[model samples]
Target chain A: MKAITVTNPDDPSSLELTEVDTPQLRDGEVLVKVHATSVNRADLLQAKGNYPPPKGASEIIGLECAGVIEDPGTTGRTTGEEVACLLSGGGYAEYVAVPEGQLLPIPEGYSLSEAAAVVEVACTVWSNLGMLAGVREGQTVLLHGGAGGIGTFAIQLCKQLGATVAVTAGSAEKLETCRKLGADILINYKEQDFAEELTGRCDVILDIMGAKYLEQNLKSLNVDGQLVIIGMQGGRKAEINLGALLPRRLSVRGTTLRARSVESKAEVVRSTVENVWPLLDDGRVTHHIHTTLPLADAAKAHALLDSGEVTGKIVLEVGEV
Target chain B: MKAITVTNPDDPSSLELTEVDTPQLRDGEVLVKVHATSVNRADLLQAKGNYPPPKGASEIIGLECAGVIEDPGTTGRTTGEEVACLLSGGGYAEYVAVPEGQLLPIPEGYSLSEAAAVVEVACTVWSNLGMLAGVREGQTVLLHGGAGGIGTFAIQLCKQLGATVAVTAGSAEKLETCRKLGADILINYKEQDFAEELTGRCDVILDIMGAKYLEQNLKSLNVDGQLVIIGMQGGRKAEINLGALLPRRLSVRGTTLRARSVESKAEVVRSTVENVWPLLDDGRVTHHIHTTLPLADAAKAHALLDSGEVTGKIVLEVGEV
Candidate 1:
């Protein structure tokens, strides 16, 4: 099996396409021949030695993949069924073994590479926006980083839930993409202040820029509002004004899906398949792929993500299953 | 009607016992002839012109009272019924007009003066700890300011709900009082560091020190724990470490019950009467009073509270109803 490994651990150019042994099946686990996998920010962090995989998981970098079952270990599914999976690690290899419960059949009529992009965004949005923040109908949602994969998926899902969606992006092109995704209010963050534009109206805010936007994110919140932070693209430390927070009855929750227990990850996967897969199957939500590259050009994918030029997801086609 | 008026906002000595006009009733409101009223920290802040009453509330001090219903308005209860009430203001007067929904029947076998202390502490604990933070059985709760009204009420309520309660106080005597109230873990905040005493174990934290304890309170939380801030006694600004908060999956909420809408307050009152009244009736929860003073010595009551020598609560006996 061929895998993408970090040879230097200090530079983006350190990735090497090297031959590795196939992973063996554990109890209640099945092996899958990798078809395609998408690149996430966590992959880049792991490549640069900043983020480590959870204990007892594979040391490989990928977090999600779309593949076909090769060896079914005590499972009901037959051989060669196309599936999308959420992995703790080991998604970067040619063959991977995962818990049977973490696999979901590809949505109707979607290609394998497109299904690879669906699992991460679907589970992230479902767990944070739907389950944690409890986004409801007739409420307003303020989504930051509106051109990214999570942002694009969240905007469409929130609209599908009968909510009014607001988005903040850095460019006209990005704002246009958000507008086409059914965003009700669009603000160019470089040109307009989001807090002033939607002060005292937002019921939930899906935030990515953590410390830099904490104050303004709180100011944009109405009473009984909740702000869920899933990324810290900005710096980590910030001053908080409890005086403003207490009187407004605000809630701030910080979470990430990468380090969760595999059981918890399986729960997220099951929920995403049940609630969000139908939206994908009916054409209400679609994949937004920027570009696809061969698995050998893994370093280029990291560079493109760092440049912030790509909208939506970037996929890597591994090989024929 | 005789009321306690602030002759000068700067001096506690400026509160004078004098005659004032009785309040007129608004729609959905009832008038009560005061038998007793209790003091709160908010009353002190209002006297010093630091905290102002909410809009449409009376300018006089006092937050809770026990009295006889003078006029029932449209309520089902007849006149002259003994009731414990949570007031927006005007509890310092001989007569007060309150929303009929805020009225509670004095618990079985409790005196009027004791019931006066119940409304403020009961409503505060039930709203912040039980409702907002969602404290449940078998979880651990860490409460700050263990000697005061909210803490005393919270200890008993948490114990009744099968939770393990932890408390912090400034003196040995205060800790002893908390122990009798069913606090399982005791930390003298003056001599011991609470964060070191209970790190990564608290399920919910009911905090009043605000900025001073923000970092420590967050450290005290276990994974998926919640910290609810109800008062800002320590300070109003602090630095938050999002790096620490995100990975642990913690929630921080800031709330205060005094400035909420009448409809919202009615909902909280309804929940309290339905869920908490039974405990009071069964003798599982009881009011703790430290002293009683004549209503004419309202300024002396304030002084006793400021001195930090009083334990439980200080009641002002207004007159015979």
Candidate 2:
């Protein structure tokens, strides 16, 4: 099996396409022949030696992939079935072994490359914005980082769930992308203060920039508001005004997809398949792929995201069956 | 009607026993002849003008009272029914107008004074720990300010709900009180570090100390722990490490019972009556009142609470009906 391995974690050029032993399938795990996998901020962090995979997880770079079930090690599915999956660090390879529960059938009419992008953003948005925060219909939700992979999917999904979506993005082009995805209100964070610009306080906020946006995010929250923090792209620590939170019944929940128990990841996948799969099958929430490159150009994918201009996800395609 | 009025916002001695006009009952409201009421921290804050009553609420300074219904304004109970009520304001008065929804029948085998102590603590604990946090059996909950009104009630409630309760208090005597209420672990905040002394991480924390304990509370929390901030006895602001929180899947929620809308308060009241009143009736959770004083001596009660020696609640008893 060929996989992307890091020679010097501190260097972007450290990632190299090299031959590695294929992972053996553990009990309740399945071996998948990966068709494609996408870059995530987690992958960049892992490459930099800042983020390590959880205990017992594969030390590979990617967090999600689309693949065919080569060996269903446990019960659920048969060989040769198409699937997309959330992963705990094995997706940067031709073959990866994962717990069967983390796999989802590729939605009808979607390409494998498209499916690779879907599970990561779909599960991230659905779990954080939908499951944890419970952003219901008719309520308002403020989504930060509106042009990224998670942001693009989140805007469409939140709108589909009957919420008034407010988004903050850096560029007019990114904001335009959010607008096309049914974002009701768009704020160019570089220009306007989201707290001041947003008319009504948001019922829910999906925050990626952690400490830098903490206070303003709190100010923008309506009574009984929920703020779910999945990514900390900004600084890590900030002063939280508890006086504001208590009176308004505000909740701050912090989450990550990779470190969670396999059962929990499975539950998120199951529901994402049940709920967001249909939206993907139709044209309502299309995959927003910024660019695609062959797996050997993993270094290029990292550089593109590091430049911070990618509109959505960047995928790495593998050799076909 | 006689009530406690603050002559000067800065002076604790400003709490004066004086005659005030009887409150007129609004639609779906009930008027009660006060038997007794309890001194909560909010009363002190309101007396000092540090905390103001919510819109359209009484200017009088009390939160919970026990009384016989003088007028059941719209429906539910008849006049002369004994009830303990959660009030927006006006609980300090001899006569108070409350929405019918906030009224809870006095549990059998308990006096009106006991009932007065129950509603405030019960509603606070139930709404924050039970409802919002969803603390279930087999989970461990760390309760700060375990000697205070909410703490004492929460310790027993958490115990009755099959959770192992850990508590932190200022004094050994207060910790002893918590022990009797089935606190499985006790950490004297003045002597030991709760973060180090606590045997295991907490699944839920009913927190009153705000900024001062925020870091330590996060440390004491287990993976997926929930810290519910109902009071800010410490300071209101603190630095939250989103870095630590995201990896652990921790959630921090802030809430207050007083300023919530009538319908929301009613929902808390209804759930308290349904879930907690049974525990009270069965004697599994007993109301813990440190002392009961004459209503005219509210100044003395406030002074005692300010001295920070009183364990559990201090009740103010009105003159005979």
Candidate 3:
């Protein structure tokens, strides 16, 4: 099987297309022929020797992919079924083994490439906003990185949940993209303080710039508000005033999907499929793919994502149908 | 009516029993003839002009009291109904107006003074551990100040919930008290590091030492653990490693019951009565009062709690039932 392997971990851009052994099907797992895989920030960290796969998971670099079952393994399932998979690792390969629970039926009309782009963002957003925060109607949700993959998806979902959506991005174009996706309030973080603009108004905040926005995120929340931090792009440590939280009944939570146990990922996949798949199928929520590249240009894909100009997901096509 | 008033803003011990206007009941409220009120740490802060009552709440100091209804204004309830009330303020008076939603039935086989001691602690512990943390059987809960008011009650509730309870206190005697209350693990904070002993083990931590235990509390939790900070006894600011929270999926929440609105308090009161009242009725949970004092000795009650020599609660008897 062909896979994207790190040639030099010290250099994050040293991803190379190389031959690797095909993944063996573990019990209750099925071998899938990966058609497309998408780049995630975690993949960038893994390449730089910062992030490591969870125990008993693949050492490969992708977190999500769209693929077709090649071998059903010990689980009783039909072979040749097309599916979108949430993976711990191994998606950056021609062949990947997926636990049965991590598989989702590709949304009604989605191509494999589009399906790949939706898996991580869909599961990530829904798990945090829907499962953890229990975002509901009449609530105000603040989304950071508004035009990015997760943010774009979340904006639409929050709107569907009957919430007022506020978004923060670095530029006008990104903010405009968020507005088009039904964001009610847009703040260019480069010029305005989001906390000041939305002070004590947000019911839930989907934060990616961990420590950098920690205080501001705390300040931006209303009474009984929740701040869910999924990524730490800005840094990782900050001073917190627990005093600020008590009277307001505020909460701060940090979560990562990849490090979760297989059972947990299964639960997330099940929920996303149950709740989010219908929206995708109905076109109420749409995938935002910034660009698509052939799997052989693995190094170039990493560089493009590193530049940070991409508005949404960058998909890598691994195989033809 | 007679109430305890702060004689000097600068002096925390300047509590004086004096004649005051009887509280007039608002719509959907009830006026109660206070029989017994229990001293809370918040009362100490309120006396020093630190913890002010919530908006529209009484300006007097006291959070929980057990009394009989004198007037059931607009609420259409029977006058003279014996109730345990969760109050925002004015519990130190001979009469206090309470929102009908915050009233609780006196626990079976309990005296008015005993019922007063259980209100604040039961509601605080249940709201945090039961509603917020969703603590269940097979989980491990860590209670700080284990022999104190909240801790002693929480220890028994956790045991009844079939959870393993760990506690931290300052002395051997306190730890012994916690053990007698069904705590499985005990750490004397003066001699041992609680985080070191319980590292990566706690599923839920009921914290009072805020900023002081913030880092250690984070370190002591297992994956998907929750730390509910109900008090800031140890201070309120601390540097948090957001990195530590992400992969482990930890949450930190701060809450104060006095600050909640009537509707929210109603929900909590309803839930507590439905779930916890049964425990009290069945003798599965019991109130632990350290001492009883005359209502005029309110100043002395606050002083006793502030001295850190008291365990459980100090009940201030305001009138004969």
lDDT of 3 at B272: 96
lDDT of 2 by residue, B221-260 (tens): 8988888888887899888899988988889899999979
Each prediction's Cα RMSD?
Answer: 1.9, 1.8, 1.6
Predicted structure 2: lDDT: 0.89
Off by over 4 Å in 3: none
DockQ of each: 0.85, 0.88, 0.94
Badly placed stretches (over 4 Å) of model 2 are A74-76, B74-77
Lowest summed lDDT across 10 adjacent residues in model 3 chain B is found at B312-321
Q: Specify the highest-DockQ model's number.
A: 3
In terms of lDDT, model 3 sits at: 0.93
**Runs in model 1 with CA error above 4 Å?**
A74-79, B74-77
What are the TM-scores, per candidate, against the unseen true structure?
Answer: 0.96, 0.97, 0.97
Cα error, residue B90 of model 2, in Å, equals: 1.3
Pairs that collide, model 2: A246-B254, A246-B255
Task: Write out the backbone clash pairs for model 3.
Answer: none
True contacts kept of 1: 0.94
What DockQ does candidate 3 have relative to the true complex? 0.94
Candidate 1 chain B weakest lDDT stretch, 10 residues: B8-17
- Provide the clashing-pair count of each candidate structure: 0, 2, 0
Chain A only TM-scores, each candidate in turn: 0.97, 0.97, 0.98
lDDT of 3 by residue, A94-209 (tens): 99999999999999899999999999999999999999999999999999999998998999999999999999999999999999999999999999999999999999999999
